[model samples]
Target chain A: MVSAGAGQAVDEGADSDPVIRVRGLENRFGSDIVHHRLDLDVRRGEILGVVGGSGTGKSVLMRSILGLLRPTGGRIEVFGQHLRDADDVREIMSHRAGVLFQDGALFSSLTVLENVELPLKTHRQDISTQLRRDLARSKIQLSGLPDSSSAKMPSDLSGGMRKRVALARALILEPELLFLDEPTAGLDPIGAAEFDGLLHALHRALGFTVFLITHDLDTLYAICDRVAVIAERKILAAATLRDIEDLDHEWIREYFHGPRARAVRDQTSPPG
Target chain B: MSDPAQMTEGRKDDNEADLVWERGTEGLLLATGDWVLDNVELLSDRVDALAGLASGLDASGISRLDASGALLLERLFHRTGQGPTAAGLRQQWRTLFEAVDFACDDTHEPAPASEAPWRQILERMGRSTVEVVHSTHELLGFLGITVHRLLRTVVQPRRLRLTSTVYHMERTGLDAVPLLILLSSLVGAVVAFLGATVLRNFGAELFVIDLVTFAFVREFGALLTAILLAGRTASAFCAQIGMMKLREEIDAIRTLGLDEIEVLVLPRLIALLITLPLLAFVATISGLFGGLIVSVVSLDINLVMFLDRVEQTVTLKHYLVGMIKAPMFAAVIALIGCLEGLRVSGTAQSLGEHTTLAVVRSLTMVIVLNALAAVYFMELGW
Candidate 1:
């Protein structure tokens, strides 16, 4: 079943156009289906958090939107360009969006600075080597990584620093949209909060849309403008935190009303 | 959206948030605009240059600040010891500045750029030597553990994975037959041709039969087959086990209370032991058949005469000696492959490196063992 009214409700609230629109999306691997008639929208310049239980296809949805995976059936549009006919999705998406993979996915052979410089070198082939290095260095610094980390290999850095390097690489091209897959999955609470704060600050300063796939409740509360809960092979709800919390879905109630969720909410709330 | 570079260029202009310097009695410097992450880079060079000249820092003119911008200001203040000037900031800005100051207190200093080339080479040499010793020690330890596990499985026959052993036999042995036969046949013909040419010059052309029979039965048959298997099956084992390790499947097996050596290594080891000798026998037969064809066609030796010569020169002892080396070669290859696979670390690069290492190591060990067997059989007057 498809929910057109719910999708339209999202469209009406945003002043700007939706950066990503998925309608009747279906993903299947042989006989096993991951998504069915999934309808969702991510508005421009907003941090939209996608949350779901394990194997619920949150990642599949993200991959479909990024054009990494071809959906079995759907009309998926990014920046109003239909992805179905694109011969090279990677090349097209590389100009408009950057993704931070869960494991950082930094090239093991390259230093952190070189990893950050890769996108710039790939896209801006005509730029001088010196200017490329300068831009990459600024991005690394903006990610809150120290100057010393520039020459170190990804394997040599801590998990948190590696994630920062990945973030730096993702931001190097200055894309209009950024995709992050479990950005804070491995970091400790303090480190995750700091990463969340960095993402929030970067979003405000750069005004780019973020499609963040995460299981971290604190991230949704701290940085997300809206939250989309995926269950039963489709989007169960897509709205702000308060609205998602009030939804009647069983999984949604369990997720938002769980003890851990309440604890994070209490901890993040301002004192009276 | 049309051109990403143009979008970045437009954003760059907006992010060049200006820095204002006021000539005052106190030589105070004022910064304005959103001195945040995006705009902070524009001020770094100016801040560093002015840090030495300015008397003190003033953030009163700053409209906004974040961690990135505050870190720069913190560095400027640290360089000039102008901490007292931070009091002029709003509460939020002051808090952020203080936080950055505390967070970056132990900031890592970049390593010095210059090092002597000779010293660097020496350091690398020393490191490599240590790594070689460490890896050798690990390899020996792995061998000992594998042997012990194998013995344990021998004592408890139920632990041996019979189905896995059969599967590996089909992969490493059965699948290798055609290539082994083809290679041995070609080599056998070449050897016969060379021997016939050389022996004919000395009026000993008939002795070509001895050369073909002795070489194939004693060394060429087992050596070629083993070398082929080392390159083919050993590398496959390394890659398979290495990928399993990378994916943590080996760890999963361990967590399930299974002995890794018994489950992973023993099947491959037993399969190779059983199949290598059989493959070597087939190669010996195929090689002799090739020599038979050459003798019949080139030398005009009849089938009866060829069989009589082979029967007389190629004894059971020579065949036994060659077949004996087959199991040893198989053991070396399988052990090396499994060892290298288990030694694989995190990356795909590491898995590739280990796979190559397995083939090289197995081939070297097989050749060395074959040489040692040759010397032993010669000394014993076989």
Candidate 2:
């Protein structure tokens, strides 16, 4: 089961074509292997939450798929196009997918409006400056940021507002797929809940396929339709929260039935 | 989800985005093709040309629509002062249009007006004058604090950061020895050669030895070492401390009830203070060796005689004059580096600006202080 192929997880779940598929993924740093034969399939229009303990290579896996880090060995197909054979891998990937990094990597020197407009300036140079600004502003508003936050620099905004700006920049192109890394980390409970609500609403309205990596159990429960647990350098199981909770694995049991998870679960479920 | 499939289908070949206006009977605007970000420019221009004629719009023919495309539609509606009817649109495109409409509803307020250019120039000059004065005040205050802590540490030797001081000494002092020796020796040889050429014309070639000794002992040795340290060690100190400040490590130290000055600045100051004078001593010796080699080879001066002349002319008075300036230069360089580092604000751009400022200030201050000391020593007849 520890070495189960990612194809197996797809066979056992909802019957939808994969948007992002990884097979025989291997990542190694010097002699230390981070992932070995890891496989995953992100289905269309599903919020697939990827979770693991610290140093379990969750970020590494995401980076490999995004082409930020080239894996030592793997076959990756995004939008049914093989990454290695594509003439312009980044061009093919970037136009279709949007990424929200963990720390809201906004440019420190630019105002929020300029940060959001950057992608349009890069990919769609034919768009008039006026239309580009309006589209960026609309996306910012759609991400639930206030009107005042548009003119301020990233350094001037609070952490939560900065994440919203990053999200706006990511969603500017109206990409069909979204990759979110720890979207709710470094936020207070209320702020995290608000962010989760915003993300869920955006996902439903946009209907983009979401590959979300998070450690916040609340985020998983609130938005994710299925959860993929990375362990032993492969996905041990990929299923709904209830099915994952019922699995008799030690880490899964401790993770799902832990005190924190219990508190979140009780709060989420309807009263008996 | 249904729209994305239709989107891929529309993008396959000749189904590119298009907008047409019928100025005939109904004056209908029929939008067709994939209306997404990729085709926004062509779409926006077409929509603008027909904005006034859009009495009735039919969007059912459009193959695909995204938020950006929705924004363009909303803009057209706003320009014509008419609300979007959404009468014949697909369900998904209708949802997208409504969402874009609601989100982009608010109009932007115009930016505040600016002052005239002439008035702005005058205001900027006056502001910079005040800023210069304020910075001078801060520099003096920081110097006072550093001196106060040094005196306190002198009284209680146990308070010194011995480990940190030694570590910095190895980095800023020991590692820089070879580069210092090479530069000093090269400059000394050049001076000796120049002196021999000029002095030989006057039939006083022997005086070249005096020129080499005076130049290296009183000016070149100390000044060169200080300038080199100003460029090298000061920039290093500024960058390292500026990064730590950027990461809030300085604030962390303070929150833990530790004096950041004692933990960070004092060690660098003490290391530079102790090592600069020693480096100057080495520079002076190597410079003299360079002069000796030139005299024996080019000037045909007797080796024993050269040694005797150097021995007699190298008085402690001249040596003291140069050696005394090293620690003063060291203090200025270290303080400016640390001060600029601590002044770094939150952004990476600010850190870079501060690092450059640290090097420029330290280098300028070193040269200015050396010039002042030269005038003072001459007045005192040292």
Cα displacement (angstroms), candidate 2, residue B315, comes to 3.5
TM-score of 1: 0.77
lDDT of 1 by residue, A195-255 (tens): 9998987787666799999999999999999898898888877888877787767888899
B-chain TM-scores per prediction: 0.72, 0.83
Q: What is the C-alpha lDDT profile of model 1 across B132-161, one tens digit per residue?
A: 898778878887998898898889999889
Interface RMSD of 1: 6.9
TM-score of model 1, chain A? Answer: 0.94
Score chain B of candidate 2 by TM-score.
0.83
Worst lDDT run of 10 residues, candidate 2 chain A, spans A1-10
Note the Cα lDDT for every prediction shown: 0.82, 0.85
In model 1, the fraction of reference contacts reproduced equals 0.00
Reference-based lDDT, residue A232, model 1: 87
Q: In candidate 2, which residue pairs get closer than 3 Å at backbone N, Cα or C atoms, i.e. clash?
A: none
